[model samples]
Target chain A: MRTARNIGYILGLPVLLVLVWWLSTLGSVNFFVPKPADLVETFGEVWFGDRFFSDVLPSLGRLVVGVAVAILIGVVGGVLIGSVRWLRALLEPTLEFFRAIPPPVLVPVLMLLMGITDSMKVMVIISGCVWPVLLNTIEGVRAVDPVLSDSAHTYGISGWARVRYLVLPSASPQIMAGVRQSLSLGLILMVISEMFASSSGLGFTIVQFQRSFAIPEMWSGIVVLGLLGVAMSFIFQWAERNILRWYHGQKEVENAA
Target chain B: MSPGTLAAGGAAPPKERQRRKAGKGAAKQLLGILGIIGFLATWELIPRLGLIDERFLPPASEVIAALVVDFGLTAFWVAVGETMKAWFLGLLMAVAAAVLLGFIIGSSDFLRKATNSTIEFLRPIPSVALIPLAVLLFGVKIESSLLLIVYASFWQVLIQVLYGVADVDMVANNTAKTYGLGRMARIRYVVFPTALPYLMTGVRLAAAVALVLAITAELVIGSPGLGREIALAQSGGAISGMYALVLATGLIGVLINMLMRQIEKRILGWHSSIRSEVIV
Candidate 1:
């Protein structure tokens, strides 16, 4: 009985919500909200069919490549500036100013510079996604334990060796946190860039569907985007867990206190 | 906004540059100043140097000139006001709804359980994905922006508020219960204070998110704002004007971040995070 009630608590509202939606849109509201059944059918149709290669794959490719580039640049640059005091101060304000510019605005500027190309879209993603990673990296790297660094220094571990052994591991948690933040930003930007200046991609397809009044198809596009977000988050979390296994272990031990 | 609280949280490593200002070598300080000047010069000279087309890559001086001229135009101020109007209203509504729902849902185990799977499902849906839906419902009006902004920022605050309400001290709550405090009174005297810090952090984050959605919505939906202006200028081949509008939005972003930090400092003064802000 207790287990049944717990199950009810977990599933109750969501089931109720779907029921209400289905009931309300049974006939009349179908024009506005297309039925749940229709949505699922369309979801399968678009995602599993030819639209997969034309729309979905290109968007995913740009997103993955953009985020990967951002992470690489952000981590390396962040470490350089973060470890060196003067470099951070000199560059900090400039970085902040650039980060302050909304990522979408850069789309127009990038279009002017590079035209409506994949490189432009990728650039928009990079500018938008890079900051959080960069800022967090700097914060994470700088926040590394001074005692450990000082020990390394005293032990004659200098320059590259000191950073490789002493710094990166300590800063990994914060760096991962930054990456998590950027993943969502990257998704937002991926759609925006396509919407603003592209011929294809998930965002353009959604707009195209809407413009043609293909309401069901538009809804399907949104569903695909949602699944993409969920997938990215799942992958990120798994990577984060594995990457920071020791950190989590220590955290659990601390929590037990 | 991501950096605002993180920078202020005092968990940051020492900003040795500020600390050693006087005792620091003069050469290092000079290089820093030179770096910024060199960057500005490069911006001014990049197109003038003929590396890029002048028509497309107008010099920094031209952009600055456009910015100065825009200051003299009523349209620029009106655009700024409209953008801020949407941002503040969306942020206010999201906060109100999130706090009310967070409290109601968080305090009840059944409600919390019931909503858990649904929130997880809904939270990660990028707000940009809703642009087409928003336009379909509201057309190219301010309402489109409001819908996207509220939906996106709502999750930020709601999640934080949920965490905050959950963080209510068990001992403090038990003490209230022993004193025969009623449910509302317990929430007021115990839960509210514990949750205020989390709420502020959420608001800081949502402010930035709200601005982002507002701009994106305007840019795509063709609403009246700086974003729309930027799009117009870019398409019309008003390159300097587009850059100026972009710069304007950047200034607004910086201002919003600074304002949020100020508000957080004032409100969270008694909190440990704010307490340590003095040393930084």
Candidate 2:
């Protein structure tokens, strides 16, 4: 009974919002605001066919590659900088300056250098997604327990073994946090890059529909994008749970105490 | 932007350690300056040596020269003003709405529960996805930029505010209640103090998000701003000018970040985080 009430509390507002939207748009002659029924129909026709394969899949593919490459670079670079005192100080200002620049502004710069290619879109994603992960990783590694480091040092653990056994495991929680931020950033960059210049992709299609005054189609495209954001977050959470099981378990023990 | 908080929250070595390292701090600063100089020298060399196409990537000196020239231009300042206007107005609106609504919703268990799923559903919808809708409604104006900026930044602030409200100390709240403090008085005295640090963090994050969205709206929607200027320069084949504008945008971003940090420091001076940092 309590579970049922909790579910009602959770779902009630969303249902009411949708109902309000439906009722307000009922019999409306406004061209921009499509009826909920029409939106549902258009969503099915627009995304459930060739466009899904041609546009959505490619966008997702680019997002995945871009985010993967970003994580690889960010983690490696962050580990290097975090472990070194002088290097971190030397490079810190430059990294902060670059992070300040909005990644969307780089779309034109990348386009100029790399042309209107898939690589440019990937670069756009990497540029934005790298920073949070990189910064967080550095912080995480820096904050590693001194006791653990001393133990490892006394045991003569150094080089790759020390990094693998001691550093990465300790920093995994923060690294995972950075990865979570990167995923959303990657999605945003993917759309922006495609919107700026692309023949095919989710962003391009949505812009195309807008230009053609296909309002319903445009709205449906947005719905798909929103769904994609939700789906990516869900996947990230699942992966994070597996990857950070020890971290979570430790946290739970600490909390219980 | 969230890194700001993480850096602050991370462990700070004790006072004696900091005092001992004081001499090294100057050396570190010098190294940082040298690093920037080295970076600029490399950028200057790359195009000069034809390592990359100079047309696509102008020499660092040329871009810097163009940026200097841009600083003197009335048109450039006008563009900056337009972008700043949108950013300021959008940030103001988002923070006001988020703080007000966050407090009201967070104060009530039923309201918080009811809105939780709805906010979760809506929050991840990237504001850029609303570009089409904004265009349809406002059509190549600052309002279009404002809509995007507000939508993007509102969530950043709202979520932070929600967390802040939830963090109120139950003991402190009850103590205030026993003192015959009314709801408004209790909120003003207890909840406000607890939430201010989180709110500051939220504002800082929102400020960054607002600037990004402002530029994006202008770049994509053709609204009048530095972003539009960059797009104009790009299409006009003024590659050097485009790079200059891009550098200008980067400078603005850096300045805004510094300003936000300053503001956060000033407003949150009495907060434990700030006090601890000072003591260290």
Candidate 3:
């Protein structure tokens, strides 16, 4: 019964949003704010077959590689710092300083230092995505009760064994949270780097299409990107729930389902 | 006091001296500065030695010169001003909207639950990806940039605000209710104050996002902004000029961050995070 009411409530904004979008784009509205119908038409036409897949596929490939590399680096580095208090103290300020510097702004520097290759794009994305995961991992590890550590010690569970059994399990939820944060950041960097300077990828495809006044195609690229973003996030969330089922505080989100 | 008398203070002296120990601290600070300088010096040396292409990767000296000479150009500052205006305005709008909407959405359990999925869906879409759509609709105008900034900043701030609002202690609210406070009064005195810390976090995040979007929008559409200047420099193959603009942008980021930190510290003096945290 409540489900119907919730559905109605959720549908209200999108419905009104579409109506207003349609009305504004009627005759005198801005060309930029195209109607929902027009957008649908454009979506159908440009996002149909090879044109859609070809443009989007490369960007997705880059995002996957870049994000995967970032996770590996971030998680490893985080564990190192988290397990050792001295290392954490030594590195935390430096990491915070770098994190404060905007990642997109590094395009010029990266291009100069590394060239505008796949490496540059991947490196830039890694730079942005690494911080959240690393920081969160530190926090996650820190949050584990020392009593648990002492208990593990008493059992003679030492070194990596202790970390794997006690720290990792307890920190899994927070680490996953960090991963979720990094995923979006990675995508943003991917698109922005491509948009900033590239000859291919969805970002480059959109910019090139726009330069030639291919408005519908440009719009199609954006919609695809948006949908891709939505899809990836959903996938990550589902994966998190599956992997971190022991997480105790997510009842509210599960209740929604 | 004599040296022996000074030593008689015992524990405090040793503890204070240990805290102020310059031995490792001096070396660490020296290493950090040396690392940056070493990096730049190597880059400059590499290009000078013809090991790297100067056209693509100019020497540090050349970049500094370009920055000095070109800093006076009208186009440069005009672009900076335009981007700053959009960024500032968008940040203000985002803060206002996120605060209001976040409060509304977070205050009710039903709305929060229903909207959680929707928020998650919107969260992942990179705002930069919306540039093409924005340009198509707004036509390389200021509105396009502003809209992009708002879009990028909004979700970040909104999420932060939501978390902030959620963090408000229920026990405190129940206490307020027990004292017979009404909904509005309870909200004004209890909810808003508790949420302020979170709101500040959101605003800081939004500021960062706003800067990114503002610059990125200019880059995409050739709009007047620092990013546009950098783009122009890059395409013109003025490598030094590009470096200079990059440095300028970095400096701007540093300045913005420092300014915001001061403001946050002053305004949120009572907050534990600001007061208790140390850099190390």
Candidate 4:
């Protein structure tokens, strides 16, 4: 019964929102304010149709590739820098400067060099998303247990095996936290990059529809993207849970203590 | 000044060691400067040497010259001021909404559970995805940028604030109740202090997100700001000017980040996180 009530609350707000949105547009509001039903219909037409293949797929592909590249490079770079005093000191200011710049600012520059290509979009996503992950990984690496390191050293675990088995796992939680932040950033940059270029993507489609006064279609695109964002976030959370199961156990013990 | 200083402070034990480390720190600072110099040199050389086409990306020297000219211009300053205004206003609005809503929702277990899914649903909706709606409603105005900025930053703060509020100890709450403390008194004394550190983290993150959206809105919606100026420069084929404007926005970002960090430190100085700061 309690679960049912909880579930109802979880579902009620969105249902009410959708209903209110539909009702508001029923009585002839502004043309731009699309009805919920109309948005649903349009969403179906654009997304389930062939348009999805060209626009959504490529966008998703870029997001996946960009995020993967960023995580790989960011983690490696972060570990290296975090483990080294001289390197961290030398690169701190430079990293901070680049990280400070909004990722979109780099889009036009990338466009100039790479043109309106998939690589440009991916590069923008990578540049924007890498900083959070890199910075967080550095903190995580530095924060690893000194006792754990000493124990590993005493057991004759010195190099690659030590880092692979212990250090990476110790830092995984912080790295995951950084990855979560970077996920949203990567998504935003994906949209912004596509918007800037008037190229092929969900963002470009939405802006194109809007520019032409295809209001319902534009609203549909927004809805689809929002759903996409929510879904991606859920996947990230689920993955984090699975990968950081041991970390979660440690956290629970800490909390209990 | 950053959280990274924790590692640094632990190593400075003796005066002689500290002095030696200071010398090494100076060398490290020099190395950082040299690294940047090397980067600029590469940027300058790459284009001028015809390794990369000059028309696509002008030399770093030209960009620096353009930045100098931009510093002298009133319009550039106006654009920067416009961006800053949007950033501050949007961030302020986000912080207000997040704190109020966070406390209300977090105060009740039922409300928190009920709103959990709703918040999750709304939180991940990329604010940039709302650009079409913003442009439709405001149409290339400052409000368009504000809409994006507020929407994006609100989630950053709201989630953090909620986490903070939820961190209040149950034991402390029971103790307050046993002492016959009023609801308001309990919240004021117990919840507020516990939530403050999280609030600072939220605000810091929100500040950065807000700046990103402000620039993005201007660039995408053709609003009045440095972002718009960059777009204008790009379209007008003033490559050097465009780079300079982008650099200007980046410099502003660096400043905003530094300012936010300082503010966070000042506001949360009583909190353990800030109190734990060690000077090397």
Candidate structures ordered by DockQ, highest first: 2, 4, 1, 3
> What shift in Å separates residue B192 of candidate 4 from its native position after superposition?
1.3
List the candidates' TM-scores in order. 0.93, 0.95, 0.80, 0.93
lDDT of each: 0.89, 0.92, 0.79, 0.89
Worst ten in a row by lDDT for model 4 chain A: A29-38
Ranking the candidates on lDDT from highest down gives 2, 4, 1, 3
> Which CAPRI level is candidate 2?
medium
In candidate 2 chain B, what residue range of length 10 has the lowest lDDT sum? Answer: B1-10
Candidate with best DockQ = 2
Q: Tens digit of lDDT per residue, candidate 2, span B18-69?
A: 6667878889999899889889999999999999999999999999999999
TM-score of chain A of each: 0.93, 0.96, 0.89, 0.96
Task: Quote the lDDT for B133 in model 4.
Answer: 92
In candidate 4, how many Å is residue B94 off? 0.8
In candidate 4, list every pair of residues with a backbone clash.
none
Best candidate, lDDT-wise?
2
The total of clashing pairs for model 1 equals 0
The alpha-carbon lDDT assigned to residue A197 of candidate 2 equals 93
Which residue window of length 10 is worst by lDDT in model 3 chain A? A92-101
Error of model 2, residue A202, in angstroms: 0.6
Ranking by TM-score: 2, 4, 1, 3
Q: Model 3 over residues B1-280: C-alpha lDDT tens digits?
A: 5445655566656656656766667666665566566666886899899997787778888988888987788877887789889889989988898889999999998788767766876777778777776776787788888888888889988998888888888899999999999999988999888888878777887887788778777776666788887877777877788888877776677677777778888888876677555321
